[model samples]
Target: MHKPLLVPEFLDRARTHYGDSEAVIATTGERFTYDELGERADRFSAALQERGIEKGDRVAVLDPNTHYHLEAAYGIMQTGAIHTPLNYRLTPDDFAYILSDADVDAIYADYEYAENIEAVRDDVPTETFITNDVDAVEGEWESFDAVLEDAGTEYDRPEMDEDEIITINYTSGTTGDPKGVCRTHRGETIHAYLTVAHQEISDDDVYLWTLPMFHANGWGHIFAVTGIGATHVCTRGIDAAEIFETVREEHVSYMCGAPTVLNMLVDYYIEHEPETTGDAPVRLATAGSAPPEATIRTVEDEFGWYLKHVYGATETGPLITTSDAGRLFEADSDDRFRIKKRQGLAFLGTEIRVVDEDGNDIPRDDETLGEVVVRGNQIMEKYWGKPDATEEAFTDRIEGYYHTGDLATIDEHGMIAIQDRKKDIIISGGENISSIELEDTLFDHPEVSDVAVIPAPSEKWGETPKAFVVPTSGDPDEPGVSEEDLVAFTRDNLAGYKTVHRIEFVAELPTTATGKVQKYELREEEWEDEDQMVGQG
Candidate 1:
């Protein structure tokens, strides 16, 4: 007997085992038990069937980290349809491109983004629109709540295979056109199991939804938490004040956020004291561009929160590696922070490798740089509607491993430290430089709050490294220091070519909703169709 591990199936199991247990807490002040969630999922599944959405259909969702977004995800999955979550911050053109590219059959959008989706509705292949807000929806879009109102609570579950596509996660394309990464039932199910094991989440834990649900299924925590019968406390947006309130009000024990989010919380704790019950410290799992060592210390010492760092991509089940630095460096505080900066080793059930340009394995000396590659069940099935791209992504840049496009080195301790993306590496005046390295060094400066490094057009040196900076404590309008002063500061710390040549002070750098800086956005404008494309002959 063969059966798929669609997420909706897990809902049924929870209903049978913990029907009365609290499953979710919405920022809107609504709570749902496991049984109630199951019934709503069934009703929504039935509604999808009525709209002619069935097995293998693609339904899109455009919303924040809300309860309805969660329900729509499971409901769409229940019909054996693919759940495609879009970055709500994307421009209308971005929205139009993805909607048409996926040929979505339907959309369940929040009221806030209803207009953006509606503007592109005509061009998109989708035939239905289910707004998240029922009362205030305008235009011809139907209400998502109303769709479930009269729908029967009983519906037939679709028969799906383990290999069937379950979700389409659109990667934040910092390099080129955004490609939708297709994930399968088997891939996600196994990922959920792995996340639980890696995070060590327990039934007594109260999981806080601080990260966006649109982000790789909230790093697959939504499913992992449900699988463990943990309670969910959802927040609408990432506000330092709101998050502090929720942490205390909901007794949030477990949460996950990017370094930026953690930094914000730590900053708030230092500047503004928030009332807390002091029951127990919260545990946080952080990744996305190895957090600064300062952040690691503040989160552990000041906020009284334990920090665990994990690394992955939208393609690799997004949980490929987690640092157990806590176990190895618990005794030495300084060593612990140093070890925490590395991406760490691969998780159980996954394999990783680093190889040279000639497809040879790089020595694990922690100095010889090579491309980081991996092969595992957790890898995406393929890029949706992109056969050539899929084939290219899987090529053996390494001997027989799927090229990850990331450059890294493994230490003797079996820990992998990601250096930078091969494409993002910079070469100035014949000197090769890791942009990430320069960025990290610059980040250590007290004046630099946020920084991104990119190649700028230079007549003499071909392409020189330029930095866009956000100041931590200074008049951002004046940048408080001259370019010469910054260059002097870098020269004290970094090599000659790696010094920041040009500095532009901005209030903030543009970032993906997940807090990843859109460096390519910075790149395009910096080059701006220049005659000699960066470092070209």
Candidate 2:
């Protein structure tokens, strides 16, 4: 017998088997058992139904990493309304666009981010507003706690199918207007299962919320960790010292973050050599970009933690592959760091292919670059309300495959390493240069704390590679390394044709809510004066 893979099953199973177990450790120093969390979710379901949120309606939640988000998300999904999460860092106009685009029926914004919603209240179709602290908000809103207390724990759950869209995750509008990526219950369920298998999540593990739950449902750990009956320690935001302290105090065994988070931890380690781990050993899974090998080395050798470098897009499962399988590497091998830096082989039951422009597969020579295409059960159903865009995404360069738009090379072991975004790769004269390669080379320098490489307009070569270096000093004016010396360093390390044409010292790079450097922003600034972008025809 096959049961429909509904998302609510995760919480129901947790409440059944782990009712008395500690489920959530809120940032406000409150703790709740699975039973309590389930009751709260039930209360929310009742409240949403009373507020006229029918099945197939969209419900938006805007909050930092917090238990309220977890409660509200599960509550929304339990009612069969698509749980549409908004990035709290977005602007009021962006919130307006997404809220109006999704036509959300109800919303729960944290006290801090509620004002952004209030500013755009007239622009959205949402009528019922809820906040954790209602008085703290200026607009008409109901208290989450009061709503739950008034809403009796009685509501009918609608029958859900595996193919029903359960969640709508919006992409960061780096390329253009953010697209709502609609995912089915079956896709998310399989993604959670794959995450548990690859990341080795277990009931005894303690998970810290350094990664935002809004970002692909905390990279699907909201379901995976919950389904596994693991303890969740929620945080309002990320900080280096607080993370280490929480790891020791709460015994956080597992967490995931982007490469910027890795850089922050490494920088923190250098400045303050505090104890990095707790009584429980720590494993950090990082994605968003290829982390520098040196950062992986420090995180492993110095911080005494195992690092799992992963890769995927919001259109996919957001975590379709990881690079930390034990069987692939020898015991305590020095070469493992280099191997783990690559986005390793595909996850169980997922298909990853690097295809040329003609839809032909590239060789596994690890040198030829091609666009990464994937066909997986965990891929998104389609872009919400954009049939043409959905058709374009699945039909680009091939049919029936979601084109990742990431240019990469696959090694002999079928592990793929991302070279650059197809739009961001620099075509200097007639040759292609991987900006990731240049950034990785600069990352090895002792003074180069962080770096981002973008294609700057070139008078002769059409476009040339430029480096933005964030020096260890944290001051752009007095960067420890001179631009001339750094230029020589890249020239000595990389191919002669891939030379970095220029270097700019910067205090920090512009990043997205999930800590990915906004290369599109840089590209826009570089090409605003030019007629068109170089890579475009």
Candidate 3:
């Protein structure tokens, strides 16, 4: 039997088998079972079709982690339209650029973020603007709820090919304008299975929405959790108190976050002394940078939650590796913490290799750094509407591998540890220095809360490592650790050449919506005036 692997089939299965189970708990004080949720999704799909939206049309969604986002995703997929999710953290101009770039036909935005789209509405090609706010349907906008109310709970299902592009996810655009990454039904379906396998999701699990839904489709949790009929507890934003309260109130068993969110929860636990023990210990998957060892210890030891560190980019199903300590090492092993700190082994149905410039695999010595390339069904199909960029990303690097542009090393266990971004590597005195290593070491300091490391121009070393430190007290000028103290501290741990030569105290590090430190932003400022910012050595 040759069945098409469409994403909407996951929802169909949930509706058929788990109809009576609670499917969603919206932060807006509404709850729905799988049957009710599926009916709403079908109404949304019917509404889109009635409004003249056809198959392959682009439908953009701009909202926080809400049930509306979830419904819109399934509805769009059911209608055979490409689901495009915009980052709520982006500026109005950025939204404008992406809307035009993707040729978006319709958009479903939350009332909180509709103004951003309103600002750029006149400049884009969108034909329909739908807002979730039913009370205040002003101007040309239509109420999302009203549309669903007037529509039926059934729509004609179009014949879909597994290779059809179902979603277009935009990159963070740290270097330049964001590129839209194309994902087919087959790729995302494979990724959803992998997510369930890696995260150990089950029907009994209750998932909290700490991660944004717009970020790689919430790292494919929407499908993984829904496909298994797991409960989805939606949150409007990431708030420490609310998260703690929800975890206790709703018995949240599984969630995902970046390191920054983890740090916030740990800090909150330290200051407020929240109850750590629960009915079932929480399982959190964290990525978007290698979290400091201190964070892992605090999360597991103090908060009584298991932390799994995973790694990937928006291009590679956004999850290619995971460091599940319990599976990789003994509970009492001394090297457990050290091993968990590294990005773990390749995920199921994925192949990861660390290679040099010539595309040859590097030795598994854990010392030699190389670019991380991946080949699997989970990889994105291509860059949308950018042939040259797509070709540059996949060709001339490896025959079938996608270059991640992330430098890493593999240990004897075939576990990969990221060193640094290729452009972020500091070549000082003919020695390569990893900024992530320096930041990880600095995070061990008692007074340091957050840190970013960038290469600065130096007459002696051509380019030297500069540390930007955010203190625990949240004051830049009054940082408890002085420059001399930090310098001596680094000298005690790292090599002389890799030690940070300059320290700049800051209130907070600039981060993306997902909480990754924007090192390129800091690097540009430090090297703005230099004729050649890169090291000549």
lDDT, candidates in the order shown: 0.82, 0.92, 0.89
Q: Where does the lowest 10-residue lDDT sum fall in candidate 2?
A: 322-331
What is the TM-score ranking, best to worst?
A: 2, 3, 1
TM-score of each: 0.95, 0.99, 0.97
Candidate 1 residues 426-533, lDDT tens each?
767777677777777877776777788888888897788888988775357876666687778888888766887888888877787887777778888888879744
Best by lDDT: 2
Q: What clash pairs does model 3 have?
A: none
Give the per-residue Cα lDDT of candidate 1 at 269.
75
**Candidate 1 weakest ten by summed lDDT:** 528-537
Deviation from native of the Cα of residue 481 in model 2, angstroms: 1.0
**Which regions in candidate 2 have their CA more than 4 angstroms from the true location?**
none
Misplaced by over 4 Å in model 1 are 1-4, 275-278, 478-482, 532-537
The worst-scoring run of ten residues by lDDT in candidate 3 lies at 134-143
Local accuracy of candidate 2 as per-residue lDDT tens digits, 255-303: 9988888899899989999898889999999999999889988999999
Indicate whether candidate 2 or candidate 3 has the larger TM-score.
2
